[model samples]
Target: MARSTGAVGPSGCAATLTEPGAFGGSLGYAQKLSDDDPALPFTPGVDHGYLGVGLDVLGNCFGDWEHRGNGCETTSPAGTAFRIPAPGANMVTLRGPGDGTTGYCFLTATTSNFSTTGPWPSTLPGQLQGPTTSLPAGVTPAAVPSTYKFGFAASTGLFTDVHLIRNVSVHPAAALPQLNLVKQVSAASDVPLPLTPGQQVPYEYVVTNSGNTTLTDVNVTDDRVTGICCPGTTLTSGQTMTCTGTYTVTEADGLAGSVTNTALAHGTTPGGTMVDSPPSEVTLPVQRGPGLRLEKTVDEDRVYRAGDEVSYTYTVTNTGPTELTGIGVTDDRVDGITCQATTLAPGASTTCTGTYTVTQQDAERGNVINIAFARGQSGATTVESPPDTARVDVVTNRPALRIEKSVDDSRPYRVGERITYTYTVTNTGNTELSDVTVVDDRVTDVTCRATTLAPGASTTCTGTYTVTEADAVAGEITNVAVATADNGTVRSEPDQATVQVESKPCHGKDCHKPCHGKDCEPCADQRCEAY
Candidate 1:
């Protein structure tokens, strides 16, 4: 009954106790612990007394399971083996009955097999069974074992020790281990190339999954245009129905620039994000031009004689990518030239016609027989044929003419008598003058002249005269001129005048010759005398 201080009992690990037959049976206990640094649990003193002994429990009824000798025993009313002695003390002593007092003793056991019945689970010394072990991140521990022992002195029989094992303490926290995502590269497909400025070629792109987990809520975006109906818009997978999208290119200093885009795949991981594509390019060509040709011919060297028929022809051709519709040809070079049709196909040519009457009035020699041909759009500036002009000379075989006469009056003095006369001419022709000239020759108391004509641009010469008197005469007086330029006989056509003479008598005065007779003449006096 010396219960004055601290005491000891079995380790608090899972307990395995066996108290066989009531006559001082032995018990064993054991448990498991962690590998790093093993630890032993501390068992508490009895919560209450058992088997008529008001003492906390100690070790098994037997000594260490490795040996069967009398266990270094312990017996105290406190149910503890002994006082904890001091800071460095290890072993404790068990009490044996002093001869027939019917007292029991117990000693702790240590073996890999210590159990209540030699069949229960065991723990070697220095092992752990509770919260002393490390819990994984976000995790907790559970299901640890709890057990205790009982021993007593039988009042009417030999000393005996009995024990029962109970489950013991528990601890918990939280822990788990899975996959996550971090850095990644974007995915794209069918990126476009650049061409000219402000012109779009085509572009395409795709988004991919490159992370450790599934992703969700994916959306794509671009500043150049709308992403949904955009040109080159594409899912990472090539299985989408849309083949292409449209983007209008803009003006910039450089050939190209960058545009930011984003994507959101529907899921819980960073792998669900949309990715951008590489930039593309497009190219264009620039140019402009003209098309049509003209040519002309009008019976060569614009020369023709009277009654000659002139023909003009022009050729129009097309030399462009497009057809020359409504084409026309004009001949300002020549008059009376008419265009029949005015249309042409590429590389095609046609001819036009015109005629001129080279009449008798035409110039006989060199003339600028200018012939110009023009071709172009119907109402547009006409493209003239190169060297559109021609020159010509003409010769003619025709007739010619000359004038031949001069005249005044002089013969006799008379009151009302007439006299007539003539002059002649010649025919000048390589050919002859068919029907010669007929003269209208008469004198009203005056003289006159006449002639015959010639052929081949012919010429002639002649003279004229007149006479007068107071008496009447019947016979005519004639004067004639010869033809000088005509070949054989230079025929003379005569012109004539007639005169009448008479007398008047007076008495008591001498009668004198009168200036009014056939023979009467007035001399160079330029005057007439009276009878």
Candidate 2:
């Protein structure tokens, strides 16, 4: 069977075959080998076993090319040198006619390396075999009678080890290429409640070859997106590939209330025919309903006073899947709000201006707070946004003053003695007090340190008074002080301080004598004080 080049040679060893009424012709053959046998490398005088398919052998199954030498190969093993299979192997193989070139005696599932294992049991009926050139189904159109060459690759061959032979045959099969497609949005986060306009929407397409043939010119297309691309054009049978593209969200998409897209995948067969997958589509609602955003702001932060003018700005935007009509802003405190347009498209924005005059009541309260909101109509539905509030602080004119009068010395005073007085003036109101001064009925020339008192500030003033003889006779004297500012618009309640006059003991004959005045009349134990 194997090293049996004696059986297969350039000699006339040919078989018979009826021309097929079918499409193309196929080749096949079968034989069993001992476990320890290795159909190995090509070398002269060494028998290597092999079979030929698709091509009619010029010489034999071993390497005997018509263009080159031919024989049972009395001189060489017939083919060039190549190691045979391992001891227990069953199949031996080589590329080309064993002369070493393109044709592989046994084509494997994927790679071009000719050496093959038990790919023998063909899935198709006839169990086709071939020299893997381009197609693995090896369908030859050329007519030829059945031929066989029993030979060896090197030292020993299938002759001695060749054990069993069964159903060995040949036939043809048609190429069937199929394609499948699936599409999906790339990022889950890119889509939210209301998809942002001008944002990128990424998509991925999966292309798969579902049939038993290779496919080329693979591509995908989307009705709503552009620039679809993929990494390669060819997809082997049962292989998959991914394609990608991006679509930008537009204002029109929002206005329509939803975005709908469809995609189709296409591929070309090796025969230059086109095949298409079923159309796929995805649709999503842009937003639930019409949306409005209102923002209100004052023109400036300057402190306001009574009758002060403040401008309010109302900015309105239409964020939605529909148009807004009869749009305007309203405020509880601001009046006569005017906008540029009565209708707005989705994603459109406009601003309106109005003025509010600060009244005396608002000034007294120190702030002007108002609530404002925007409203619009979408078809038959009336929509309004959440109210926005704006506040303006105003200055209140409430000026006040306070003063306290006190004697510089702490105790009893003598007649005709100089007494120094101190007056403190404080601004107790929120406003500044100008022309602030203190006045005392008994103390004269109250020189003030400052004529103006800022809010929450204090100023000191000084004055001097002399103890009169009458004051000494009265035993005690009191004086009042009041602060005045801003032409009496601000005044303080009067504050007073009193000092006692000390009584002198009568040292002369008056010690036992009664006195007329209270101060000089009498003291304890008949004593008298002189003024």
Candidate 3:
């Protein structure tokens, strides 16, 4: 069989032979296209052979082949195939654009025919091809072809062979980082009502790498919390990292009624490009401090008598948004008063009681005064209830009477001599006195002007009495009187009056006769004379 060589064109182009009937069995010339070409079953014109037989034979052939004596004139021309070897997955890693750097990639294309003009054009998407370069003979020996002079005509000759191609693709790798943040009350893990000062809160941030490339120097930041950094310095595709931070609640937070926090993620690609994730934010509601109230009352009436027992009641209530603890009650006047509930929930109330006994001092003062206090704690703050007071009036009984008695005679009295006695009664008690009367043991027919007497009132009466002979002999007359009030319910000590009777002084004529005249005879020393 006769052997002939075919002319080679640039990679990605079809190779053909112009000589016809070079192979004895064929009546027409054939042209073969690359298998990688999208247009298949290409129709040939009148000067060309049938479709399937021409291109199919050479399209499936690899390396170099020499035809024996089979009457085949020319061999198939070489074709180029493109591929990426370094990054087998067709992906590359790069730093962010901020780094002012770029990522490198290598692409290679192999040819079936040998030629000095090597490498090939590439249609890879989003990539630009670099200058063609040669590979060592040991690297691709099949791509190196043996060159010999082949004559298409007596005066025409050309050089052709298969070529091994290699080219690089330059591009910026993608750098993308995503961030999310969440905030919650550490105690409840939810929005806590009535959140006061000194309460602990927690914040969480999650960072993810969603780009095709790896990220370096990843960092996280929060508006409320500090020291937010990822655990890893570098993150591959679809990798995620989480960080946590804590914050203490403050009075300002409670007053604001809400707390807001924001988180942001930053990273750099190998290409020195700076990238940032969208800011994520979370807001939680805060509750105010507890409100407390107190009310004090008494079971008895406002007025109470001495030696009476009084019961005092105290009520404590919580009216704020949160619960209160360490609740207690106290009264200035009442002792042993305690609240049984140690904790009070919002809009809840509890009651306690204490007892007090009335004393004479209280009665004298006319009223009893007391104050009650209630207190509780909400978070780190202490809350107090408005003070309450209870007043009571006390009463005491008082009834008294007094009397005085006197006799009309001031000189010595004889038997059968008439005398007048007088008596007075007074009520010195706080209340009215009824059935008031006076009695004199030594006098008869003594009565008071009035029977009933009001406080600070007085009554008087008189009676006639005769001096007794025995009283004259004794030289004195005494009368005792006493007063009674409220129908003898109360009595006063006795009052007394006395009259002194002396022996009558004698005149010169009659020694036993009493001095009857104002200028009665007087016993003189020696020159005494009767008048």
Candidate 4:
């Protein structure tokens, strides 16, 4: 016999032997045992590990099926072939020779056939239970005409003194790949002060391969953020990786009080199949003064079909310490919003309603997602709440656009003062959009950073407007902006932004007027209008 040395097992994957006969090498004659019962198992090789062997068709016998804790009768082992009884289903055969002598045992596992051969009712008859011979990774062993390996141990409970591996000859490893990912905000972001607009929100993602196989082409991404960096794209089995990413908080996120986002992870298997992990989500609190909260929800609890009438409810609350007037909801898809009350006191709230008939185009794409915001006046300042988003199921890859408009200040302004207006355009659908443009009714020249956008991408456009004497007397300036993408084929509903203009006295002066009973700075030509 040839002499050599090596360690082998499911983990080591040290050797591959395939020929209808006994295994050779240091495992040749099999070590002798001094103490224990003869009934213990010496197969599977998980304790030390399995020697990787790829097989096409199997025709040899595997032994000691009864010692694998299967309770198989030593007298009639042939009846142990496990079957599922499924349509056209079959299982491997287990046979024993008529001779009373102990038979040699071999362990086998499947690769591509894992899908059909698994969800096994119990461990294979020849694989041992507990830890010693336990399969690596504790995953269901594939039962098909695939890889075959044998194991010898350093004395099982009832077997003779068997020597563990004593040599070194390794083979290329086989794979059983699985991927797991976890996402969280960096501890540094958790501070006494809530994160504000333009502040950096750091995130960390932990990636791991939960299976026995190596994974390649691994990637991690966030739906609402970008610029993620990981050391490498390949992960060996049982290896863990950490990736980092960042996002800049927006004013909308602050006004809404929180920012929520989801991250996804995926990897490719050797067999070319892609394995994806369930989405992981994290919500970060944002800086905001006590303000209005609009909770928007849909009535549908199930998937929607064509012609479905979707009812949306808007619950507007005065979360601020002061009262708000002109409280109402405005949606991107509906018109004529009706509310229970147009004014809310410090802690008061009211309900608003709207209805939409799902079109076939929307139903086919999956579901509908709409955004809405509320507007109210607190003293002389006109305040608009941040967006309240709602989703049903899905959206088609068709071109779609969304726009959010906001102004630099909410405090009452005097004539001749300039207000900086920001119009943000976003591509919400699953397709790339070209020539994305924002048109504000008030600002004729809106300049944006990018005119093109991929799905879920956004761009900020800015313009400046000078408050006029007419705007001061009107008490406020309401500016509306609409965005268009895909050469105007897709258009967004109008988004309105308002700023309070100082109330003018009997004769309109460019001077700031303190409200209702308070004096107007630099008294106007005439007496003040209020108490």
lDDT of 1 by residue, 1-531 (tens): 101011112221211223221221121111111110112222212221111111112222222111111111222222211123211111122222111112223322222332333321223223312222232242221212111234322211133534332473332232211211111111123222212234343433223333344434433333343543322322233122212334544444122343222322222344444433232222322111124555655543233445566665766555332444565555544565455556655445656666555645554321225546555553354443333543332324222222233333344334353333333333433223333342434322221233234343343322333333313232233333233323323333333333333322222222243234433333211223344
Please give the lDDT score at residue 40 for candidate 1. Answer: 22
TM-score of 1: 0.21
Compose the digit string of candidate 3's lDDT tens values, residues 411-513: 7676677778877888776567888877778777777789988767889878877866466556688778888877788998899888876533334554344
Query: Between candidates 1 and 3, which one is better according to lDDT?
Result: 3
Off by over 4 Å in 4: 1-396, 507-531
Candidate 2 lDDT trough over 10 residues, lowest sum: 18-27
lDDT of 2 by residue, 166-185 (tens): 45343224332277776767
Compose the digit string of candidate 4's lDDT tens values, residues 266-324. 88888888888668787867756656777787843333546667889998877565789
Clash statistics: count for each candidate: 68, 28, 27, 15
lDDT of 2 at 525: 39
- Stretches of candidate 2 off by over 4 Å are 1-196, 199-249, 256-293, 298-311, 316-332, 335-355, 360-388, 391-401, 431-435, 445-447, 451-454, 489-493, 502-509, 514-531
Candidate 4: clashing residue pairs, number: 15
Candidate 1 Cα outliers beyond 4 Å, as residue runs = 1-295, 299-311, 317-322, 331-337, 354-366, 378-384, 394-531
Question: lDDT of candidate 4 vs native?
Answer: 0.56
Cα misplacement distance, residue 116 of candidate 4 (Å): 23
Model 4 — which ten-residue stretch has the worst lDDT? 54-63
What is the lDDT, from 0 to 100, of the residue 513 in candidate 2?
A: 63
Reference-based TM-score, model 4 = 0.26
